[model samples]
Target: MKAAREARSAAVVINAGSRRGAASTELAVDAMRRAGVPVRSVHPVKSGTELFQTLRRVVADGHDLVVVGGGDGTMTSAAGLLAGTDIMLGVLPLGTANDFARTLEIPGGLTEACAVIADGKVVDVDLGWANGEPFLNVASVGLSVGVTEALSPRLKRRIGSLAYGIATMQAYARHKPFRARLEFPEGDHEPMELEDVLQVAVGNGRHYGGGNIVSPMAGIDDHTLDIYAILAAPLREHVKIARLLKDGSFIEHDRVYHLATRRVRLVTEPPLSVNLDGEIAAVTPADFSVQRNAVHVIVPQSSNSASFEGPSRH
Candidate 1:
């Protein structure tokens, strides 16, 4: 199939704290100008509402593409607004994790990302929703949620992925699993009452939290969500799982349960914490579904040919 037209007029939105946001915007603007593509507007947003408003303004002004400069959170926020719309979404990876970009095989630097956008080649990608919010990468609950929530921005910037490692250690120290009832689209119900569950991750893209392949077999073009339930195991086993995840071998580990479905209902007894994309959304008893081909994304040709490995902990 022929790719969609590259936008001649684009709106660039950046999340200020994204590691490379400012530089990426500069690079993109320069590239667009070089290609003779007019930049309709540039918005640097501080909060989620501002981001949404900026997107609305850009769409209202008839901008053909929305180029986002930030990490997974910013991309996920933009995807929620532009999905099912004619406006194509382009990404400039400035965030720490940049999970969506990795899944699309978009290079890490701003210049390369700008070149991809200038080259066009838009394709439809699947999006996942948890309680009505769109998530382009992964939504996780349980231990991962607690760890991410407990982490401070200072820790993340100063130590990078090590922040997650520290937080994971702290969380595991207090680890306890609750009873959960999982309902699948096919009317099958599985009740799990365990003493230890590390986390449950629902993946729209194969990766999240700075390149962890939480769902190795996930495909963005496919209309399905890959689910992983990381059970609590011995500390040594957890260490082994973490190591395997880094090398893309965690999916086959004995402690992890993997499933793929379009919809899942999760009900937990004590209400576990939930993380959507990288941000905390809510506690348990959450409903999730996959919206097939819900958004048009600009991706490198390599993304279409690449296979994904499941997520791992840093």
Candidate 2:
């Protein structure tokens, strides 16, 4: 645990892209000032490495907390640096699908989010890793990757989640099945050939693909990872699954398989494209593992109940 003086003097780093909320970066700075917390610095980042570099500087400067203001991708990028460290991460949900923020019950509005941060109740959260990259939401291979690849930034900003919905329709028309072998650390291996598989999502949190609830029962503090495999199906079935997801009924669907594991290795007959926390990573065969209690997060004390509740696989 960091000392009180250290926590109060912590610096916050916000991704400029996360500036969509009404409480602009200026308000964040002003709030920090009002709280009598010194503003170490606020830096803008364009790519993943840049975010890491800024985080490193913040840590080296003895800042006890690192606050990120962008969407999931930006948060994932910064998470790798804070894992296993003493720095408490504060999130300002400014991205398209603030899935992590939603799970934490952090409001979308910046002012509310900042108020939560100012309260400064710290929580320990679990983070998952694919190879070495940190992902707070989910990572997957197959149709979902196709949809992510097809959606342009302009379309995403203009249409929001509708862009992914449109991409799913287009991807469904071009879907094909593939053979994959999933090997768990306990020596359980399952080899299956799938057709029209929407995708395979390995979730650390409960949401992905723009609030699609890829792993409806996932818990961030749990030491396990949720692996959700969506087999390719007809357009009608795919639409049905999408609808079921909103109501938390997708878990009972026949085409979906959910597993809880500490580590998983995926091998595909043909190389498959993969997305890690919404960012494209190398193609399959990928190795995934959970880093238990991997990072410290600054969350509201009021949300403590939900934070510790184990993930539901129902």
Candidate 3:
């Protein structure tokens, strides 16, 4: 244990709407108390608005750390408060996917995750912004926005991560290619246009849409956003690339464009919904940027030594 250096006094907020919220919160509270953190308050919020209001109160009350229990959506809602602030954020993955938690190498086990928070190895990590809105994991448009719209809570509970894959297929069938231009103003790259764009995902962390790897070498601490664009292709070609993506080797696929940059902008002919983390947060034309080392997060010691794959230029 590293002596709970960054988080001595803390407050916890659990999203009552989360699938595992109630059960996970009880276990997390007991674990936190055992880990020597004096939990100043514990709140169960029914909506993102309530969760953020509670978090603001917690920060005002002098709590140094805020432990949040929910899925990626809940995290994204509260990200505005935590990112670029002195307050440290601790996550308890109690929602579907929990993609950001996966990126941090945080265990899903309640007791194990608590131990990581208790041991307290805090480090800085990047935050992704979509149209001025902050997100912890990834933000996307096109197929993903459709997937988010169609995703049912019942399906998520029954099939877990597979639900995303199923929804992807369903969304893809109804999806029409949209024309979009991507500009990397900060990186000084030429604006690129795609006549047949299916989906564009910008990842602040490595994993998104469950456990799928956005970029093999992407890391939260790397200060760069990983961009993955899946263009319109034949069903057969899509199938082949899906296989490669499953193996974290999709970069070689021509239809799949990959870029690593600090900032970029996506402009569509007609504005499209942008799914940030897991919820539809904003709409394009959206500006995506990275706030380097903007958040302090607790993680296991081994995570500090974890290696992330970098962009592989083809």
* lDDT of model number 1: 0.75
- State which candidate has the highest TM-score: 3
Model 3 lDDT per residue over 1-314, tens place: 12345466789999978878867777789889987877878998888788878888887887788898888888776666776676777878888899888888889877888888888576676778887898878899898899997789888877777788889889988998999899998766778898888888898887787777887787777878888888999999888977776445786789988888889999986789999988887988999998876767777877862322222110
TM-score of candidate 3 versus the correct structure, residues matched by position:
0.93
- lDDT string for model 1 (60-103, tens) is 88777888888788888888877777677878888777878888
Error of 3 at 85 (Å): 1.7
Q: How do these models rank on lDDT, best leading? A: 3, 1, 2
The TM-score ranking, best first, is: 3, 1, 2
lDDT of 2 by residue, 183-262 (tens): 78666555444555567778887767766665556777767888877777776877788898764568678988777888
- Taking every candidate in turn, the Cα RMSD to the unseen true structure, in Å, is 4.7, 3.9, 4.2
Error of 2 at 4 (Å): 8.7
Which structure among the candidates has the greatest lDDT? 3
TM-score-wise, the better of 2 and 3 is 3
